[model samples]
Target chain A: MLKKILYSLTAVLILVSIYLVFFYAPIPVDPKSAGGDPENFKIFYFHLPIAISAYLAFAIVFVSSIMYLKTKKQEWDIVALSSAEVGVVFAFLTLATGSIWARSAWGAYWVTWDVRLNTSLVLFLIYISYLMVRQAVDEPEKRARLSAVFGIVGFLGVPLSFMSIRLWNKTTIHPVAELNYSTFSPLLTTLITNFAAFFLLMASLIIFRIGVEHLKEKGNEMKRKNSL
Target chain B: MKFLHIAWKDLKAEFRTKQMLNSMVMFSFLVIVIFSFAFGKESSIYISVIDRKIVDLLAPGMLWIAFTFAGMLGLSRSFAGEKEEGCLEGLKLCPVDRSDIYNGKVISNTVLMFLMEITTIPLFIVLFSYEIKNIPGLLLVVLLGTLGFIFVGTLLSALTVNTRTREILLPVILFPVLIPVILSAVTATGVLLAAGSIFEIAGELRILVIFDVIFFIVAQLVFEYTIED
Candidate 1:
């Protein structure tokens, strides 16, 4: 019953978010450029929400990873892996959309040593490498334990990289972290809805991914039984 | 004491075989040689007539790059010997806690990394035609940075020890966490080599110091979970 509610809500929220961000919300203007990012800044609505969702997914991974370590439960491991896989997808979208936005606003796709972008890039790399590490290990239990350790360690980069960027931003020539729209703007309304939509979407996707894993496990078990 | 015993056992084995140390030193030498032709003050290359200033700007980053990749070799092998021989199982049988085992690996690993640097640093000076005026400061930064490197490296080395892709997996797991370590090491080395103000170098050094302390404790506490069956 609850699953039905969640599925319907996710579908509605996603459609609403797309409508609001694409049609209802006003496009953001770049203060640096003439005529502003009237068209390009539109990606901000999608990029920002997905980025936040990615962070949320990783936080879930961290908590579930910790719980897995404490209890030695396979369920928690499944939760972490599911969250991470979803997180990696969302993270890639965020980076891709962000680059598009950067190209329009900054006139370049990448700027080296810019703390915020570099931090995001590094964060993306760390988790991708986490998935790689997971794939490299064969034993299920051992893989879970090792990947859990990595999940925890990789998430530490989120806060640490931010701090390093903020502190070390002084020496570098790159522009400071982006602050596109001011607070209390109408855009905030769309941003909030998009945030909610992405959260629901992430939750829904995690459930499906975990369902897929469970199905795979069941199939493996049936194969073993049939062999017997 | 048991932790020391594990470390001593590793050291004794290494002393006899010299397997990890020899490879690490040679790898650093090879990397430095390549780096020199690419960045050395006087070289015949497409990026020709590279100035002293450019080399100064680059030396810290290059030096640490060599240290980091070479250190990865040592860290990966530090556990390869244990996992390959099924020696970790024997160690597990002795009833020592995971913390002891972790510290044992970190200590032995740090010592071997230092031994590699003993040879690699001299080679770096000769190849780059560089002289270290602030030897003590550079040493301090290297020690703090290397500790942070080994702390994360040893943990991930053990984490990947049982994996099919252990060789490739160690650096994948390690280099990301070592960002602060490597960044600060480069920054501090640049400052010291360029004879910048103490105030200028202090921030980067502080970063290395903090990284070493936090990661050392974190690695010890968390390592047990990684090793569990």
Candidate 2:
């Protein structure tokens, strides 16, 4: 009951922080602009955090996979699945926001052969394959083990896919700048706060998903006992 | 000794059947031939407009494109044939190390891929009129790149061969995960074809070798778990 209350509180906080980002926080000026007064770049605050959050979700999948292999427990499998699902959601958001930003800045909606974009799409497909593989296999042990191996292999690609564009010297609209002290103003603070809220939201979702899996497991155990 | 026997058995079977090798090699040849007609004509245009190097530079990407697709076909069939024959279960029940099974599959897949590369390289040169001065370096890249593919492909093949949609799932699962290998291979190949100095291209080559080593170790370590019933 206490955990449920904490989850609810975190979910509410996430919504409130999102509201703050859209309405209360001052919009940032476009960094690429020259000479004019700063234009509202409020979307960047949301866009970047969501993207980073998605990558974090994938990292969770990777770690949980290792844990699952170590413990040979089903709980970690549940964690891995939930993270992949949530990671896919955030990854889609990243692509959508990225496309919107690209349109605003580059006057184009899409660019083929952009290595980063292509790899992200590939990552999404790979995760979808994970879910599909799980669904196709009837045996629980087989599903868990296969998905675990795939989760580890798929996460290994994350860094390589990200670096491929840079290595190939392909042009992408996404900015890759290091955050500095000067970049952290009032607007930046709100962005960081929003990021924290989203992170909390992700945690809450994973917890909820895990609860569902536990219930399913308990129900299966009871059914087996009753049959015997 | 026992592992080698199993591996040799697989190799002998592959040679006698020649199904996977023939399909892969044929597909690779068709791709190069089609590209020669479609893109080869435009090569001169690009050469006249850009530096003459563009044709050579694009050679690596073109070759990898063919190899990747053909390799996917080969990988999907790697374990499927065993599964179809009901031999995979017997192998799993064998007393030899699971890593040996992985190595055996990797070796056969590597051989099939190597043969495809051997057939395609000559065709690529003949069709593209590409100079063959750096034959040794290019062969080295092909060997390393093919190793990278076989390392990951063998694992993914095992993972997907039991699935309902094995054909579709292998590429979807394998390509994204092997981006590092593809990137490293393509870059190194491009550098070699462009006649870049060996020192200049060494970084990309090193990345390819490292990727091959890391994934090969990981796959071998994880194969037993993956094959568990």
Candidate 3:
């Protein structure tokens, strides 16, 4: 019951934050502005946070993979799978929001050799492969173990994917710098609040996914008992 | 010692069959031919005159592309062949450490890759009209790059061999994670081709070395779990 309440609270926070982002926050200065137009600035507030959250999701998967390897327990496998599922969701969101941002900023929807873009595409494919590998094998234990190993290996690409832009000299409008605290106004405050809210939303989604997996495991156990 | 013994056995088997070597060599020749035709006759002659630099620039990409595809072919066959022959279960039940199995597989894969590189470098020179200047640096990059590929490939092949779409799945599964290595190799080769001082390409070289170390450690650590029932 308490878990249910926490989950509901997290959902509310996320919804309210989304409302604030779209309706209440002041429009930001246009990133392209030589003089400071603000129409295109709105994407940054939403887009940056979602991209960061996607990375956070991958980090969670990486940590959970290490835990699974160390403990060799099924619960950690659940955590790893949950994190991977959420990572994929956030990764998809990142790509979508980024493409929109790119259209406004770069005047195009996609670029293939762009290192960050390619790496993200690759990361998404790797996770999809992870899911496929799990489905391909029939033995549950073998599936879990193999998936965990792949999860760990695949996460190695995350940093490479993230850093590929810097390494390859690709152009992106996203600023790689600390936010200027002095520039903060109510709009910045709201953006930060929304950022925190989305992160909590990601956490809640991962928790829900783990809970679903736990219940499925229990159902399998019960069916086995009945058969016996 | 035990790992080396197993690795030796794989080498012996490879020598007897020559299947992986033959395919990789043929594929390398095919890629060079395609590149030559794509470049056309005059450009091909010019490229051959500047052959050393062009080959140096293109070699890592060509080498890795060939190696990656050939490695995939080898990897799928490595374990699937074992399973089909009913040898994998027996091998697993033996007293060998799982890491030994990984080492053995890597050794054999690396040997095949090395052979392919050795055979193809001459063929690339002849077919592409590339002069083999800076042989030492070229060989060094090939060695490091191949080791990195084999390190990751061994583990991925192990995991993918059991999958339903093992052949198609290995490259998708392997390439994304190995991009850093591939990128560094490409960059380093380009730098070397431009006659950039060794100092200039050092950054790319360092990245390759770092990836090689990280993947090596991770592969060794994870191989046990991947192979376990």
Across B80-128, the per-residue lDDT of candidate 1 in tens digits comes to 8888789988888877888899999889999999888878989888776
- In model 3, the runs with Cα more than 4 Å from the true position are A30-37, A111-115, A161-165, A221-228, B46-63
Give the lowest summed-lDDT range of ten residues in model 2 chain B.
Answer: B42-51
Candidate 1 residues lying further than 4 Å off, grouped into runs, are A28-30, A33-37, A170-184, B40-50
State the DockQ of every prediction: 0.59, 0.54, 0.56
Against the correct fold, how does model 1 do in TM-score? Answer: 0.92
Residues forming the 10-long window of minimal summed lDDT in candidate 1 chain A? A170-179
Best by lDDT: 1
Q: List the residue pairs that clash in candidate 1.
A: none
Full ranking by DockQ: 1, 3, 2
Worst 10 residues of 3 chain A by lDDT: A28-37
Better of 2 and 3 by DockQ: 3
Error in Å for residue A59 of model 2 = 1.7
Measured with C-alpha atoms, the lDDT of residue B85 in candidate 2 is: 90
Per-candidate TM-score against the hidden true structure:
0.92, 0.90, 0.90
* Residues B87-154, model 2: lDDT tens digits: 99999888999988998888878878888889888988877766666878888888988898889888
Name every residue pair that clashes in candidate 2: none
What's the C-alpha lDDT at position B202 in model 1? 78
Candidate 2: segments with Cα more than 4 A from true spot:
A28-40, A111-119, A170-173, A176-184, A215-228, B43-57
